[model samples]
Target: MPDRSSPETRAVLRAAVPPARRLLPVVLLGVASAGSSIALLAASAWLIARAAEQPPILYLSLGVVGVRAFALGRATFRYLERLTGHDAAFRQLASIRSGIYERMLPSAPDGLGMLRRGDLLARFTSDVDDLQFVTLRAVQPFVSAAIVLVAAVAGLAFLAPGSSLGVLACLVVGIGAAVLAERIAADRGARRLAPLRGDLQSAVVEHVTSLETLVAFDAAERSRTRIADLGERLARATRAQAASAGAAAAVMSALGGIAVLASIAGGLPQLASGRLDGPAFAVLCLVPLAIAEVAAAVPVAVAAWRTARVSAERIATAVPAEPPSGVVRPPAAAVAFPSGAGAPTLALRGVRAAWPETGTPSGPVLDGVDLDLAPGERVLLRGPSGTGKTTLAHVLVRFLDYGGSYRIDGVEAAELDPAEVRRRIGLVEQRPWLFDEDLRQNLLFARDTASDDELLAVLDRVGLGEWARERGGLYAPVGERGVLVSGGQAQRIALARAMLADFPVVVLDEPTANVDPDTAGRLLDDLLDAAGERTVLLIMHSVEVPAGVDRVVELTGRG
Candidate 1:
């Protein structure tokens, strides 16, 4: 298993599929397209000059046929190149996205907490999209251009190697311009990466997360100023990159002029010596443009490659360093546990955990913790603030990788796939995430085909039946993150979602924290009633343990 936090994780992630295999189709098509384009330009130039001389139709026939064939081939190959390139890039992007998601699974909300939501969104969305350069604007074009350039120069040598040297000289000048453009683009790339460094993105996420609070505090003006500042900075950085790209484009156009002049200068001597025919001289003058066109793409390709590298570096932080051994292999079919069935055996000893990349010197958040829950047993996990109560809850759900022996059904938890364990041991976090969807949609998210009766039953179990019924039944929209509902109502809806999953064991993390004592008691009682024979781990900060909880386990807070 590679350490995901290390630099090598990027390499490991990128090697998920064979590189050459994925790139072959796009590269082949691109090379064909570029080759055909060069041939078309030379053929058309020759055909036009021969026709102007009033040569016999048969003498011009070969050039005319060659021009037509190259034209058709160029267009056809270019269309195929785009189709192949985008298709391959999209497929690679999908796999990379899924791999990133799976790698980030164990960390969950805590891992997400390490980075701001906005920055993280940038990584998962934009940064990942930047990887399309693996084919689209980077590798395929770079390789194809090199091949086409070589072929063009080699063919020009047959007419006059002396003139070919001039074409080669022009290529050198074009390359120098591209290199200069890349240097400028590289500097701007550094500036562009700064906005995603948590400051700018953090503000965006914070203002949105606390929009209501900011409005109450009358800090909207302050936030707007900050956002404007960030926007301006980002805009300046973007313009710098665009300017660099424009410079590269200008170099391409300049290369065309330079190559054309060199062609005339180099080919005129060959024409005077009678070593090259007039029609052939026309070929020499235009052929350099083909090679120039390909070489001119170097600067943009370099910039695209750099952008992908920056994105890869940022996204590497979110990918776990130590992926489990078997994650690459498909998981075996799951063994189903009936709803409300008695729980599997749960045990832990010398358990410890810390956020992987947080660089916290205080060590593991939860240390040397020990607990055991018999089938159908209910346990309360109690601790002070920052004492790792939430960590323990996450451990129970296999959300966090821990230091010691943690097992379910007498098998080590590490031995089971984290995703598979989550299927059997459902968790309701402190702050549940509700999508902007109808009640039925949210409930059905757990079990897609769950009957309406089952959904209504779970809502009743979580004490949200009246709430659901009064609010346009199950089809009623819940607004963004359930903003339309009270804190307590949101919590209940999340609980209902879990109830619908009906795992054999459940871990409730501070589920009643936002409600009044009486409401808390009622919710707790209702949850216990709903659990019935199922094992439960109730993680709470308060000492108000409800009746019927089997036992209470306090954190020793020792490593």
Candidate 2:
């Protein structure tokens, strides 16, 4: 299946930009910088011409001063453009990161589960950083350089027409060669980055997540060796990219030399024929040198262009496992689950699915499965490892594709809209994630606008109200993944977040896996008690199902 976010990702990213009015200052700065570059070149040429004519001391001094001021102005504009452009790029990247994350929440078990932690980190850090180059440097530098080149050519033509035309022709050829070189190298660059980046990310994830295990098993050396191997591969790939960029740079330099030579050849003949003077001839030669700076940016532009496309392709391939098409509707109109008997029911009839990579055709994880849960039914799903319990949970949430028919209040689950399915269901995975923020922010995961009263109420329901109050309540930081809180407390916080969603269906994967028996029982009681008006689907491996759960179902086979 293709990712749904690809086609529209560019559009979504663009929407994050500031208004045109806000960008006008940046554009004006670019114009000023370009004009300054041309002026600086022209002044330098005039200074050289005067030095040769009679070496007028006053003109020489003034010209030097003028050139310095021009350079300063150019530098100032360049800095301002970079500052504003990068600022805008970072803001847009933040918005893009958020959007991608939001889209992945419900589709996580389907697509995100397939990604390594390090690769996903790359998406937020490296890939997003690459876009800064694309948005700020890639396009802007080319535009500014082109403008300066055009202005320089015009100034040269006023002094020596033949030389100006010669330089322009050479520039055209140089650009063409650089573009061709880029095209030839782009595919190889992408291919080289693929396994190399993937391997590095994979190794980093494995090493970091298993650091304790590796040390305990005395396998740290082995892990370090594997990381070293990945680093070497990455270095080789980077070298290849650099080599291609170098070739393009060489081409630009060679062409610049040819252009300068042509200018000199044309100007010298004009000077001998009495059509040009020595000072003017020297000025004409300076035109090509000024134009060369513009050509120098070509290689960087090419590299940035290739990198942006590769980054886009990587992100597009990862999110939205299946392409988005028509608007996705909910599985049920109103808390419908279990099927025929009405009210709100969820049921699966022989649903089957297989992981794409392994190509292992397992039986329908819920093989000929039949389930019925009424409103307020807190059912505990019991199964052993590899029994497809997790897979079943994902299907219930509409993340994975299923073969057989599954219905929510008679509506086919497949026909329901994805966003609607998500809005109607809340999930608490085994490893519940909490961002590095305060408890208040974490509790508002689904409802950012949730009131203080609502937040406090949910916290109290999860049995953390008193503890949180003592620790400063909402203002207290939770650290990364609720590290500041105890395992049982984190579990309760996660439950509170899910409960606060007020969704019709709530799903959890081994919520008590890390909690003590007493806490686990208390947490279960809190969840079931609060679920008075909602349905709960608890996925657990242990046979110790919570007392008073509405129902219990067991899976017999491993698929």
Least lDDT summed over 10 consecutive residues: which range in candidate 2? 323-332
Q: State every prediction's TM-score relative to the real structure.
A: 0.82, 0.76
Candidate 2 on 93-158: residue-level lDDT in tens? Answer: 787778677766644555455567777777666666666665565666666666667777787777
Runs of candidate 2 exceeding 4 Å displacement: 1-32, 51-107, 132-140, 143-151, 154-158, 165-195, 239-262, 320-360, 401-425, 517-539
Report lDDT per candidate.
0.76, 0.72
In candidate 1, what are the lDDT values of residues 266-335, reduced to their tens digit? 7888799998898899998888877788787666676776666666666676555654321222235444
TM-score, cand. 1: 0.82
Question: What's the lDDT of the predicted structure labeled candidate 2?
Answer: 0.72
The pairs that clash in candidate 2 are 328-417, 329-417, 336-344, 336-345, 337-344, 337-345, 337-346, 338-345, 338-346
- The per-candidate count of clashes, in order, stands at 3, 9
For model 2, state the Cα shift of residue 311 in Å. 3.2
